[model samples]
Target: MAPLSHYLVLSGILFTIGVMGVLVRRNAIVVFMSIEIMLNAVNISLIAFDRYLGQHDGQIFSFMVMAVAAAEVSVGLAIVIAMFRNKPTINLDEFNLMKW
Candidate 1:
């Protein structure tokens, strides 16, 4: 079994990676997945904190984040689908629909 600190460290690393992906990736889908990764990483940290502090606040926050993530995924995927139908590409650079 891993120690609590180990989980926390791993979660932090994952969160960093997700942030980097969001910053570096030009593909909208990749950015969306990176956001999801960040959210999951947060959940991991929240669970670890919940365990360490002997409280349910982190767990409750995790649930709330999960709900928001679900809605975000739905809306994000819908936009991606719509964009692909119009432009046939998912690259952010190729999206000039809203650009001047």
Candidate 2:
């Protein structure tokens, strides 16, 4: 069995990649994907810790995170589609929806 530290390192690497994607990418879809990756990274860490501690709390919290991610995906895609219909582009830089 792999050590807990290995799992933690992998999770950290995945999280770092996700953060970089979110920061460096301009497409809304890519950003959403990155967010999902970040969420999964967190889930991995939670499960790892749960296994290490022999408790179910981490698994339960991971499920909650998944549920929230699902909701976020639905709402976020809807908003993206609406914005694309109006402007024909999904570039984050082109969006000024909140600007007056």
Candidate 3:
């Protein structure tokens, strides 16, 4: 079996890639995917640490994160769909963050 350090390193790499993707990508869908990747990376790290520590807290936290991610996906997809209809584009620049 691979060592816990290996898992941690892999998780870190995955998270770094995800952060870079979010920073460089303009499309909402791509950004959403990057967010998911980040979440999954955290999940992997949690599981690895949980196993190493011989405790279940990390696993539980990871499960909660997965639930939250699912809810986010559902609501996020709906919002993106609505935004697409209104703006006819998924570009981040088109979104109005300050408007009431």
Which tens-of-lDDT digit does each residue in 28-76 have in candidate 1?
9899999999999999999998988889999999999999999999999
lDDT of prediction 3: 0.96
Strongest candidate by TM-score: 2
The local distance difference test score of each candidate is 0.92, 0.96, 0.96
* Predicted candidate 3 versus true structure: per-residue lDDT over 38-88, tens digit per residue: 999999999999999999999999999999999999999999999888779
Better of 1 and 2 by lDDT: 2
For model 1, the local distance difference test gives 0.92
Which lDDT tens digits does candidate 2 get at residues 1-100?
A: 7999999999999999999999999999999999999999999999999999999999999999999999999999999998888899988998775976
Q: Please rank every candidate by TM-score, starting with the best.
A: 2, 3, 1
The true-versus-predicted C-alpha distance at residue 43 of model 2, in Å, is: 0.3
TM-scores of the candidates are 0.88, 0.94, 0.91
Question: Which sections of candidate 1 miss by over 4 Å?
Answer: 1-3, 97-100
